[model samples]
Target: MGTHQLTTINNSDTFEDSICDLFNHLESTFTYKRFGKNGHNQKGIDVFSTEKDCAIQCKKKDLSRKDLLIKKEIFNDIEKDVNKVINDDLKVKIDKLIFVSTYKDHPEIDEFCEILKEELNTDFEIIYWGWDTLESKFLANKELLNKYWSNFIIKTDSKETHFKRNLDLKKKIAKDFGNWLNDSQANRKLRSRILLRAFDGTQYPDENEPDEFGQYSWFRAEIKSLYHKGMEFIIGIDEIQVFEDYTWDFTSNDNEPKGELVNVAKVGQINFSDIIDYDIDGDEYYMFPHVFCKFIHKGTPFENIYYYNLDKTYEYFEIKDKRK
Candidate 1:
């Protein structure tokens, strides 16, 4: 359900609250309820509401409402999966797939949107409630954003909780970083990119293979640590440079530079353990670099400053194979 007029009050709210509010606002306003056949929910289609008898799959953002950007393209993958499930269930043609978000600039969130437009072979209209989009479309509804400014909680993992607990025990973690980003224009400076990981020794959904649609793709990394011990998830980052005019294909997605921003470069060195507060001297590691392409140029530095998506591909992936 991605074609309805969605109006969100806030980007930040508790998980329970966001889900409840999303259901309530749309259902009450439109006289609709979730459509469940055989008392079953076909995943990804979180809120399937019917407005004027039309079905809408109200997909929520798989995010933490914290200081990180949600991975973008996965939403498109979700749409594919959801559509697959929907089509398999239906005998007649289906309706639209409406993806709702709070922020429009999120890489993972935005990337999938582009894919949706292409995959659906039509306008994958992703609606969001943010200052950037607000001024453009909802200057009249500015009061709504101002009134309900909050964030939704990203579901947590046991391992992530363990890691967080460890960090909490040592008081090594930053407190209220989310609040910091929420408070000012400072968040604009804190950008991140999205990366895919294969922990169970293989990529989930297998991006290189084609689906019934014959497209080799997968959804955004929403539920982290989906597989354990040998599983992995895609991650979003702020340092990767995404070129505006370029597309990321396996065979040379990086661009030939020109104009105001000539090239984009990563800062100092790559250190996986640096992000980990706990020790990792013995823990194994890997490397598979992803170059975030935006309107950036070469020589752009990363350090509380601008960065670039590194262009070169290793003999292997960025998050694996390096152990080097």
Candidate 2:
């Protein structure tokens, strides 16, 4: 959801009324009464709720252009409201006083509230709800925002909601180069340097060990096939140390090889439009949109792309004869 500014609402009265309405649903027992603009001017409170024992004062200032002059105006208003509540009979009924404004919350308000509370020797809780607080509540109950304060949100749908559009873009790229990628494999194989995470408990290769393709050789590579893109034998280096410590250098400029020689496996090409999420450690992430596109452009799949395959080492699987 986009950020909703309270000042952008039609009028200050409407903004104040909508706030009372929000509390009506949030607290079922709360009885909200508005007495601000319609001939009956509220003493200080714009809205008051009996069940919640609270009073709200709403202000819709030009929050975008905040200066010392504007801030002094807000402070003066607060001082006037506090003075009114101090002498009023309703002060005894409500314990919580909330000041709602479209402006960004400042630390000075907290200091001001503490000073007022101490000077008056009152147990009443005084607090200010700035743009941040109001925005959160508005987002939580979107129906209220849509009906009463629709103008706050300039765009109903934000860039975060464009997951479908992003996927479509990826698919279009694949389609544009699909035929060439398929046919080029037979005529000329595309070789790429891939870094694969090591299986758990895999021992790091000893410096004394010979550089060869074997389980004991401490260096291995695997070939992953992109179905739509075609069959290209990708050399995946399995790191000697645990996968966590190994930083993947996309340039492959580091002179040391990380993992042991592992078997090559064929994977079916993934459809970008309808790809399932990859769940790792209870976190869900869209796999195809992220990794496949990277492989198409950067030659590196998402981290832990081949972790499952790395777990079971295949001695018989070979890429020597298949390498072009």
Candidate 3:
């Protein structure tokens, strides 16, 4: 699980419904219902709770689409809504009026709310629930978090440890792949593509010029062997294709061989397990799981590869000639 952030709900109706659900979750004793459609003649209240004598006016605003900074116009809008609730004649006596907004909290907004509260001189309590407050309540309840924002989840201590362990395992697999590329001396070749960061004097040796178009370049290279200096793993290639003049071609008339340092993070999808010789007669053959590499700047390399583990089962393969 990863850290959670409350994303803006694009649909205004959906945002109101979610806020209703969140209200119910927070005040379990009270059942909150959505007020009339389009705010109609039902005053400024968007949601209400009869049991709690509470009324909430939802303001769905996407600050990202607008200037992120708080403005005077928003404060004016808040004042108008508060006044509507104060003056409107309703069936139930509203003891609490809350203004719920998707906007992130700002000190100016808080000061404005306080000033409104003082000037109103109303019997009911005036409250403002901003993005920060909503996020805290959503995180406290997993059901609300999953229902509204499912992309990211709350990270507990045990889940955090598991995530760290999985990351470490992926790093180890990358190092092991580099070693396998070096030790597999057999004349077997795997057709693969890799994305390389532009020739930087600090990271990459100045053997090739910097790409004219961008900071990253794609190369179709044959994985021949691997060499390492400390933590850096350099890959040796024989047939190299460079992108030039809007086409991929061999460099110069004499197609020379070259070596490139592999950025472990940018390693493309080359299933080393596909080339393994399965030994059925040997002891229990443990198959390593396939790791789909995520390139930094490029789109997904292969769409056919299933990136998710749906069944939660570990499938193993037997390696007949396991390289040392």
Q: Give the alpha carbon lDDT tens digit for every residue of 1-324 in model 1.
A: 111123444333332234334445544564444444324644434344444332334333543332232433445445675555445564323344444444343454556555665766642243333323432343333333343442322233566665555455333212322232233322323232122222211223322433233322222221111111111222233322233444222212465433222233322221222222212111232121222211111211111222334334212222211112
How should the candidates be ordered by TM-score, best one leading?
A: 3, 2, 1
- Model 2 regions more than 4 Å off: 1-7, 36-41, 151-324
Backbone clashes, each candidate? 50, 8, 2
Residue-level error in angstroms, candidate 3, position 30: 4.7
lDDT (10s digit) by residue, model 2, range 173-210: 45643543345333433332222222211223223222
Q: What's the TM-score of each model vs. the native?
A: 0.29, 0.45, 0.47
Candidate 1 lDDT at 19 equals 38
The whole-model lDDT of each prediction reads 0.33, 0.52, 0.53
Top model by TM-score, which number?
3
Model 3 misplacement above 4 A:
65-70, 157-324
Off by over 4 Å in 1: 1-29, 36-39, 52-69, 76-82, 90-94, 102-111, 120-324
Which candidate gets the maximum lDDT versus the true structure? Answer: 3
